[model samples]
Target: MAWTTIIPATALHDLIGQGAPVLVLDCEFDLGDPARGRSVYRAGHIPGARYVHLDDDMSARPDGSNGRHPLPDPAALAARLRALGLHRGQQVVAYDGNGGFYAARLWWMLRWLGHEAVAVLDGGRQAWLAEGFVLESDDPAPVAEGDFTIAPALVGGVVSADEVLANIARGDLLVVDARDPARFAGAPHPLDTVSGHIPGARNRFLRDNFDATGKFKLPAELAREFAMVLGETPPDKAVMQCGSGVTACANALAMEIAGLKGAKLYPGSWSEWTSDPARPVATGQA
Candidate 1:
């Protein structure tokens, strides 16, 4: 539970006048343009930054019958992080502009609700405007509504669908797909409803977790790039998944910012394991 992947200009110079409860979440998302990411954060953002809205503040509206961003209710996300001021000893600093992909889903939903001083932002806002920093073209001063709480370990980072078919019929489980490499090789999953992955999954390609300036790659270089899909397996039975569990919580938050041990999402992942046509889809390679 020790993680940090920051670098929005060294976390905006560790926040100018310094305000250490340090929050800056802005998870700008699009997934086929959902109001074009709060209209690009109302045309400007980052000084005190706020805007969440991954389909209304990191998801929970999917009534087309569940699954897309379906991991919201932790007392309604601690009352939406105490009306966006967050607490329980704050220090969150999520970000997004396609580099932390929805800011690693609010830095893995604020450390799965237990709040471990979240951090992601490594190259989000495109590396904080390529490190020139200081953006905030106005729009920020709106806080002070906080008091956030919720902390039952957000149900300990969910992994359902009958616990992934009883951990793939008790082979003792190890799925881990985090999409790409042509949709895990079955290719063509521009969203889902075909194109492979799932059966004994193992592609692990969330942009190899990040580097080449999209940040986040030191934690022994992300444990030597996820030790090739986490071989020698030990990261809590490893589950993860993608295409709908949002970058598989950005590869389980870059394997807990590479101290590598937190794996367990799959929240209706691969849209409920490819909506079970009697589940079982694997194509090409893995």
Candidate 2:
């Protein structure tokens, strides 16, 4: 079976060294400094890992309405992946300096493009370093392009801002916000002009999914925690959101890893939600 949600650093190392055809991508990124990710990757990264920039590869230019990091064009992203030698039957592992924050974006993007054999490196580059794994500063030779095709029909992984509003109005869907408690409570507007969360959304900070060491919590623990938050709501009836839909994928990834699937992403998230003056914004916990 393909590693679909998350992979450990040891497993990733073994895969790249001896397992089936694998494509490792370094997705290190800093939201404050976009160029720093590439600079860091160039400095040192996992062997045979190609760098994927969040702005250039994973997301499109912000249009002031589509949130900060809108999903890239499917065909364009597929072409880029193909150029990176991504093809059928290849397991793609994405990692970053942060604990799968940016890495999960690429993981979700691959699934959105119809490739299910992709995963985020659990604990990411931090865990790799902690494991005493060797890093490679030299760039590898160019890889031959692979025949990766775009499957637009598989684009059922997202929900629109309007859909989110409708869900809130209907009071049927469980909208989960991945932002920190402070940001969700409408205080300290660091990134956005407006602070607060969707009126009916519940807060489930992404950091809560990880342990003190920064690794994700056990699958059973995650499932139980989500179960408490979800109550009677099914996984399919839930939607995940964050600042600009980037870190939201982290929550979605955690859900999938915990065997709770079918959660849709509100790609517009708080950034796009607050873009309109008419939208209602709620402060404090849910």
The whole-model lDDT of each prediction reads 0.73, 0.87
- Write down the TM-score of every candidate: 0.34, 0.96
Q: Give the worst 10-residue stretch by lDDT in candidate 1.
A: 1-10
What is candidate 1's CA lDDT for residue 239?
A: 81
The clash number for model 1 is 0
lDDT of 2 by residue, 211-259 (tens): 9888889999999998987889899888889999999888888888798
After the best TM-score superposition of candidate 1, give how far the Cα of residue 152 lies from its true spot, in angstroms.
Answer: 40
Error of 1 at 111 (Å): 23
Regions more than 4 Å wrong, model 1? 1-10, 14-47, 55-66, 70-102, 105-119, 122-139, 142-175, 178-197, 203-220, 223-227, 230-240, 247-249, 252-268, 281-286
